[model samples]
Target: MHEQLKQQLEHAQAGDRGALARLISVLESGGSDAAILERCLRARHGGGYTVGITGAPGAGKSTLVSALLGEVLAEPGRVALLAVDPSSPLSRGALLGDRVRMQPHAGSPDVFIRSMASRGHLGGLAMATRSARRLLEACGWPLTLIETVGVGQVELDVASATDTVVVVLNPGWGDEVQANKAGLMEVADIFVINKADKAGLDATRRDLEGALASLPPERRPQVLETIATEGKGAAALWQAIRDHRAAITASGELEQRRLAQVRSELKGMMDALLANQVQRLFEGQDAHARVLAVSEGSLDIATASDQMLDLLYDQAAGRV
Candidate 1:
């Protein structure tokens, strides 16, 4: 680790807000700068609870998160929000429009709000989401809220990364079918039927209940109702989240989930790094020659794959 990098990381670990921001920028730009990440990981008390709020578009996820932010601000601790927005396809840029909806608490020192674009990433999360979470964790924020890009099925992946997954649903928008789907149902720790002030709230609740009834009691997630825009039922939602956490803890499932998440993240990072390295190595190379050989029956796809793997392994091992 360079002295300067170490200092920046140390400052972040020491709760220097500015240093923490800079560390996040470095990670967002794809710079490994492993020393900083290592320090941040080590400094992590892992005390924070990351709550993921996700659902279909127009389900009032943003409003729910904004209201929840307000509720969390009233408490006696730091809180951070990571709002993930869908990226523009042509420009491959994320507009982060949700931040505009959260302008009321923008200047609060105890609250940190960040708008992250998905950058056309497949997982419905920002490219630097993991690192961003680490940065927030390093900054002494005891709670982190991740508002995922609500793109239907893919949003389920967002749940695996959080301590608790809250799937916010609207009253009449395919509520039953969404809940019955394997992906969303499996990932939901708690279900929030937001916009409960509207009609069909009971129907939505029944739909969710019926779907959950088929699952084993131990696998069922608690369901809550919220009129997020008016801040109604927010306390009950919060209490439900806490109770869910307590249940997971008592069942010894929280540690298992954490370990699984860590392993998944590590594997994803390694896979991306390896793929990038392989692409760089083979760029503008004689791939045509290999293809031609394979076409002519002189080479096999398995052999080609093995060759590529060998090259990648060698490069990773510093033997290239």
Candidate 2:
């Protein structure tokens, strides 16, 4: 297994598209090979810039991303695009509708596009995307564009993972201002008023500008208007993102932010591992019997919980 992973990693590094696809597939599924691959990639990782584009559905996020892809690829370098879509509640599979919208760059060797279902992650990103971004960096892609599930402004994990966060909004976003205050406002490094050809554009832009002006000058984000379908403002938006990245790099804030995210990821992993163990224990016959016993009043809830805790500790210790 180790030797096979090594070969795949070598091929991916050497720019073999098939090998890189296999590597990304392994990482996306959170398979057995994933941790090994991530560790290997971590050693070779020269960090690249990740830009996260997030906002409400119908905000033209896909169109903006398509435009930005053209802008980014104008300079020669590999780019990886992850279009995260909402998972089907029953099937838990991605609809992958974003891929159809991004078909313009389908054949670009320097551009690799992948669709990921959020898989019930309410944060609007597949849980594996951070690892995938690192894998992209290791595979020699110098830039990654993460387009969120477009569930709305509440999606913040993509912002946490990326170096720059671009929040896209439509012309009628004024009424949603209060709801967005907690989500997009805090994460946006740049605000994009997409679909500038639409009528309420000036009003939407002012709403954004007014809210931004009330903040301290240093915390203000750049606001730009874009007609994504016509390819109107992508270049300026890209430049704003680059400028923000450069500013954060010189300010040492980028390292500070990434360190915090790493700690968050580690703690999240530990919590999830423990939760999965507890869940497995609950699925066992003995645990089921205990649950039925509690329901029948033969066992109290508190006592049953104590017994479960004991079992958990025993099981964890045995594994250790």
Candidate 3:
């Protein structure tokens, strides 16, 4: 893996489009190529800032992300975007049209856009998103945008992954009452009232203002109005994001957040590894036969669970 990926990483860092795409594909493939990724990161110290764009569905998130990408691309640095869409159950691949909405810079060499499948991952993000973001950053994209699958209040793993989280809402989103209810209020560093050209815009703004009044000054997010389709408020939104970036960087919260992300990611990987071992046991013929017998009343769930645990322990002991 190291030898195969070395040239690609070098070319990717040098702004080769095909090489960059290939590197991103490798990361998205979720292969066990840790050494390759490690080498890539070693080539670049911290590169880009990531902005996580999330909110309820129908909030014009894709439109808004496209507009925001316009803002970022106007600058001189390279940009990469990941638009995560829900996966088809049969194919386990993205059922995507999100990328279609962002055709404004479709032909730009400075911009790279990729769509990823949520693959049943909760909290609106693809399971491989963090790795992909790292790859983009390593490749010298100064700004990476992640557009999530748009899950609602109950889930928000995106917050743990990015430097900033922007929550976009449309007018008439329960008039600030919904703001307090959804988990969006907590994670948002910048709040965008998209589709502001619609009716009830004033009402929504007031409600959001009222909701934000509860938080202490520094922690409260900046709320801006945007009609993303016409690109009316994207520049202001970008400035607000820049301000938030400055605040976090000046306050040392950026490093703190990255450290927290690293910890969470490491723990998640360990848990996934352990679960995979247990799952492999369940997939085996012997375990499957035993479980079938349990279902037939020849054994009990408690016995089956105990046997699984014993196998897990044996595997752990073997690793030791």
Lowest-scoring 10 consecutive residues by lDDT in candidate 3? 118-127
Q: Estimate, for each residue in 110-218, the C-alpha lDDT of model 1 and write its tens digit.
A: 7777766544332324346766787677656788888876745445565568889998887875844454467778788888998888999998889779988998998
Off by over 4 Å in 3: 31-44, 89-96, 118-125, 153-155, 174-180, 285-307, 316-320
Residue 1, model 3: lDDT of 62
Best by lDDT: 2
TM-score of each: 0.87, 0.87, 0.83
lDDT of 3 at 131: 66
* Candidate number with the higher TM-score (1 or 2): 1
- Order of all candidates by TM-score, from best down to worst? 1, 2, 3
Q: What is the TM-score (0 to 1) of candidate 2? A: 0.87
Each model's RMSD to truth, in Å? Answer: 3.1, 3.2, 3.9
Indicate the worst ten consecutive residues by lDDT in candidate 2. 118-127
Error of 3 at 314 (Å): 3.2
- List candidate 1 stretches off by more than 4 Å: 32-40, 89-97, 118-127, 152-154, 175-180, 284-288
Writing each residue's lDDT as its tens digit, candidate 2 over 110-227 gives 8999876534331224457776777778877888898875535325775667888998888877555457666777788899999899999888888779888877887799999999
**C-alpha displacement of 232 in model 1, angstroms?**
0.4
Task: Write down the lDDT of every candidate, Cα atoms only.
Answer: 0.73, 0.78, 0.74
